[model samples]
Target: IVGIDAAIFMHPTTWKASGHVDNFNDPMIDNKDSKKRYRVDHLIEEYAAALSAEGKENEAAALLASMETLLAKDDFTGLKKMIDDNKMQCAVSHTCNWTEIRQFNLMFSTEFGTAVSSEEGNNIVYLRPETAQGIFVNFLNVQKTGRLKIPFGIAQIGKAFRNEIVARQFVFRMREFEQMEMQFFVRPGTQKEWYEKWKAKRMQWHESLGMPAAKYRFHDHVKLAHYADAACDIEYEFPIGFKELEGIHSRTDFDLQQHQQYSKKKMQYFDNDLNPETGKPYGNYIPYVIETSIGLDRMFLAVISQAYEEQDLSLPAGEAGTEEKKDSRVVLKLPPVLAPIKLAVLPLTKKDGLPAIAEEIIQACKPHFRCFYEEKDSIGKRYRRMDALGTPYCVTVDHQTKEDQT
Candidate 1:
């Protein structure tokens, strides 16, 4: 449950052995006429969302299924046909003639040594693209040193890079972003049970955030990854549509086994006592891993989208006033826990010591929470400004406050 910085310099070997060195990439295609590069998956997802918005849910579902099938099969022709049939226009180009998808490496390359005397071993280094490798590499070290029991998990929140071809939809898929991930260690034969537990736990975590249950769905992966026995994504309904925000995978010792073979090291745990039910040496076995990974940026974006609102806030009391004079305002309506600025201090008047009082209040509250003080324009304008910035509370200092008995 505790968060720690997973420092670099400890995971390069893990990345290399995990096929991340070769496979941590996305297929990007460019429109010849538009000179814009796009990640094919993103483009298709946008098209799907648009179809749904137009009340064409059946068409949207069919298009999404077809796209998934084509992507899994790597059938470029079929993918293009799906896009054409759906009238998928490039957000960048607004045209249908997109280029054939090409692989784009996500890892960023760097050199370790001097450019002049760089020898064969000194040339290439890559910025770690994913933080999962760090957890995988440290699995045995943590268990042995921290004395962590099996069935416990290591949770990490760290930066990862993807060199996204199309970094759009605000912060959904950025080139550099943060990830919150947990890798749970379990007995080899009992991974299925643990996997189900972790899946429920992860879903509960999302539900605790207070988003609608209907807007989130479990998408079981039809095609499994190299390491996964079973996997499912907790897809959230974004402003765009339902898409993956978090993934839960049952990785059955593939990571530890790969690293052990590649590094020439044994990664196994020993147990002193035997299980009476099974009655065998409970010793020296690589634990199966159940992983729950969520992209922080995507989760933040989903929260913002869900919380953003435009509503008629005019009270019935305001009906007595003219339509132009009626009090109606657009409010961000962000949850208090996630509001960027929790409080805003406004001076009722610029002159008469109100500004000074507001400043004093700001100084007092800044140590406790994020706050803003303003004396510009009218009090109503300042409140409106704070509302636009998603400030949850606005406090105005007035002449009455300056005359406090205390």
Candidate 2:
């Protein structure tokens, strides 16, 4: 809702107020032999998976359950002992020699200027770990500028960075990634209602994208952030497994309140809308936020993983069923709206003015959406190629089209 790039480089204290300076950390362990650092949870998970693969299902489950208990309480000693006891080894080093688990801050910090020094701590700034803070800091700017009332949202898509100790499956957890976030501010007592509303709406959106509802489910948070009173993740069935694709949270005015205390600026909204209980204006107060955040890269992974398919288009046709079947075709049956290319215009032959007609079709479709034109391949080959590229449809221009311009 606000201008782009308006808050990329926020003041250093903005993060301090947002709790990133102290609270944004992941428990990490180092492999003494391999000299690699890994998030403690990830290390335990890998070891547990190995146990499962070895047919020690009960052991794996017990290990995972204990790991969660330790993680929830930030039990470093128990975490270390758990690893040592299980003989967990580094995948790289294949050795059990490991460093003690410690909290590692995920933010990537950098010197801000030529004159910046460690003594001048103000110069040390961090790349934002999340985009929600930007929206929170700019809360007043957007509300006043847009003349927005209560129960309005500020939407932003921006790049955020984190020094991930464990980067997992391709683009699943990256050091740098884009986030699509919306911070919906509402009357203080209305957060729970808005949280449930946005949760349903977001799940509906995922299903409308041609993915089956069975492939998605809600995962509630066991431990909430300091700022969040309620939170849950929308997990999608990815190729790797069911993982978080989006997060919905009820942040109960902690952000705006913190900013007000730190920045000495009032973030209160004088709501004129009457409350049903009091029949009076909600009056001046910090607005609670219901946030919906989706990782753009993770969404891409979800879409492509679900869309990709390999089909055997071959059929039994000859007598006695002795005929050879056609080779299987690989297609990305992407939803038409999400496909990179909407149509592929293929000329059946280079001669008989077929290529010219195909060119004409391309010109018309190109303005509306992406269109691919080619005359070098056979019609069947071109169709296969388009399917592989996730083009939703293909049109073959041939000699018969010249008869009546059809």
Index of the highest-lDDT prediction? 2
Error of 2 at 107 (Å): 0.5
Q: Write the per-residue lDDT of candidate 2 for residues 1-406, one digit (tens) a residue.
A: 3443446677889999999999999988899889989888888988888888899999999998898788778889999999898888888999999988888889998878887475857687888888888888888888888898888988889999999977779999999999999888888777889999999999999888878789999999876878899999999988766889999999999999999999999999998888788999778999999999999999998888888899986776673277866768889989887888888888789998888888888888888888888888578888888889888888888778888766
RMSD in Å for candidate 2, one decimal? 3.7
Per-candidate TM-scores read 0.78, 0.89
Q: Write the per-residue lDDT of candidate 1 for residues 1-111, one digit (tens) a residue.
A: 333457654445666788877767666777777888777777787777787889999988887787788777777777766667666776666888877777777877666
Candidate 2 lDDT (Cα, whole model)? 0.87
Clashing pairs in 2: none
Point out where model 1 deviates above 4 Å: 1-3, 9-12, 46-56, 80-99, 115-122, 310-330, 337-406
What TM-score does structure 2 among the candidates reach?
0.89
lDDT of each: 0.80, 0.87
